[model samples]
Target: MAKLRLFVDRLSQPSRAIIIFCLANGLDAEENLVDLGKGEHRKPEYKAINPMGQVPAVDDDGFYLFESHAILRYLASAYPNVKEHWYPVDVKKRAQIECILDWHHTNLRRGSAGLVMNRVIAPALGHPLDPKAASECEALVKASLDTINTLWLNEDGSFLKGSSEPSIADLSLACEVTQLQFLGEETKAKILSPYPKVRNWLDAVEKATSPHFESAHEKLRTLAAIFEQRRESQSSEQPAAQSDL
Candidate 1:
């Protein structure tokens, strides 16, 4: 069988999840960088691979797949040698993970993307901030965190779904929360402080997937730094603009 070809932009949360999963499992695959910043994913050649022109698509031999969650499941199933905890065979466990993945799309993932785009991407794109949209997204994120804290995580379980080990659900959700890194430290802390369980779960996921998780997130770290610098520059200019007014 041919090795999988993963098309990804590391700065993307889902892309980081896929990359970290593959690396953690020692999967037979090669990373094909799809530079989202350069609009590489939108190019005609790339569009041929995925009509949506999204990063984190994969090509296994001639078969192509999109959507980060679907890609994660396919990889886990195709490579049986991967750890069972990732996509478990046990019916109840598997169902639990599947349920979490499905809920994630509409809840955590959606909110995280909206928040990151509005708070960080909009400024960088020279677009004015939309306070209403940002507030809505923040509410969604907070609600999702509340669900994870009160429902998904068990007091005795180290991961979501009460699994003894971390699963793709954990990875997916952790990546979403990590998007908060784009905000300033104070803002990030204020948003996350109420969810102690979510924070503990994130720490566990980071520990389990680490080194690879950290490696895959290098792009996000750099992007966060860039956002911070831009915010600082904007802040410095605000006083001058006010003085002139």
Candidate 2:
């Protein structure tokens, strides 16, 4: 069988999730970098692979697939070696996971990705920061976190939906929360500290995935440092500019 080809950028939460899943499961796969920073994902070559031109797309032989959740489900079913815990065969269990995945896009993704993009990524990409949008997104993020803490997670298990082991849904949401690492420590804590259960589940997911989780997030951490430095520099300049005024 031909190895699956994953086109991904680690900076993307979904992309990192896919990469971590493959590594954790020991799947036979090849990673192809789709550098979103350089607009590589927008090129004609990448568009051919994924008409939507998104990171975290996969090519299983000639079968092309986009959308991280779909890719995860496909990989779990198509690969014989994948552990059932990731996507259980029991109908109810799988449905529970699916419920989380479906809720994730509108609730979690918007808030998490929106906050990151508005606060850090947008300015770097030449869009000025929008404080109003950022505030709205942050509110959504906190609401989503509250939901996760009170609803999705339970004392019966460490993973999402109270599963004993981590599932693709767990990896998906964990990576989304990981994006908060790029925010300044004070801001990150402000957003996350209210939900201790959410934080614990995140740690559990990382531990379950192990070294692969750290490896996949390496670039995100590097960029987080750079973003922090940039924020500090801007802050120092702001004081001087105010003094001049």
Candidate 3:
């Protein structure tokens, strides 16, 4: 197997998941910064890799892939040495896991992404996201959290698909949860306090994959600087205090 290449912005939850998954699984991959903070990802060079300008893009030999869920699957499937059995070979188990992961991207991650983008990145850059949009973001975030609460209310400790070991679902969800932590301590505490099992599961994930959140703080610094620049630029074009979406 050729050394893999991962183009990513560490601050993005999906990107972080892929980065951590690869490291945890002992897959050799090169990391390149596609700094979203600086809008560098929009550059043509990077766009050729991921036209949408998203991170967590991977290159194996000559093959390339985008959309982080696929990347995770590739890492787990193409290289079985990772010892990530939670992915499941059994059709039924794999189907269940895939369902959770798919739901996460559209429902769970979507809501959290709005909160992170609106509260942290938007104002910090220059855009100053609409106050209404910001409020809506909070509502959606609460909804997402409630769903998490329901998911783990079961007597079983399984975070997803009755598996104790971490899987793609855990990887993807943890990345989003980390964003809430970065958004504000208050929001994180509230959401996590209600879901003790989820919290424990996330901790287990970090422990299982040594250095699970490696370079997380470092990632914040890089993202912050970019947000500031965007905020300044956007604030110039329109009032930063724009109300509602």
Q: Candidate order by TM-score, highest to lowest?
A: 2, 1, 3
lDDT of 3 by residue, 1-245 (tens): 43799998787788888888877777888888888878898899988988888887998887989999888887889997877564788888788778878888766787778777776667556777565665686677776666666664243655554566778877788778777755445556775786666777667766766665656536664555565556556667786542221
Q: State the lDDT at 40 in candidate 2.
A: 94
Candidate 1 stretches with Cα past 4 Å from truth are: 240-245
Shift in Å, residue 225, candidate 2 = 0.5
Per-residue lDDT of model 1, residues 1-245, tens digit only = 53789899888888989999998999888899999878899899999999999988999988999999899888888987788899999898899899999999999988888887876688566787676787799899999999999899855788997777999999989988888888766677788899898888888888898789878877788888887777777768785541211
Best model per lDDT: 2
lDDT of 2 by residue, 45-155 (tens): 999999998898999988999999999999999999999999999999899989999999998999998888887789678788776887799899999999999999865
Candidate with better TM-score, 2 vs 3: 2
- Kindly report which residue pairs in candidate 1 clash with one another: none
What count of clashes does model 3 give?
7
TM-score, every prediction: 0.93, 0.95, 0.83
The alpha-carbon deviation from the true structure for residue 48 of candidate 3, after best TM-score superposition, in angstroms, is 0.8
> What 10-residue stretch in candidate 2 is worst by lDDT?
236-245
Score candidate 1 by TM-score against the native: 0.93
Measured by TM-score, the strongest candidate is 2
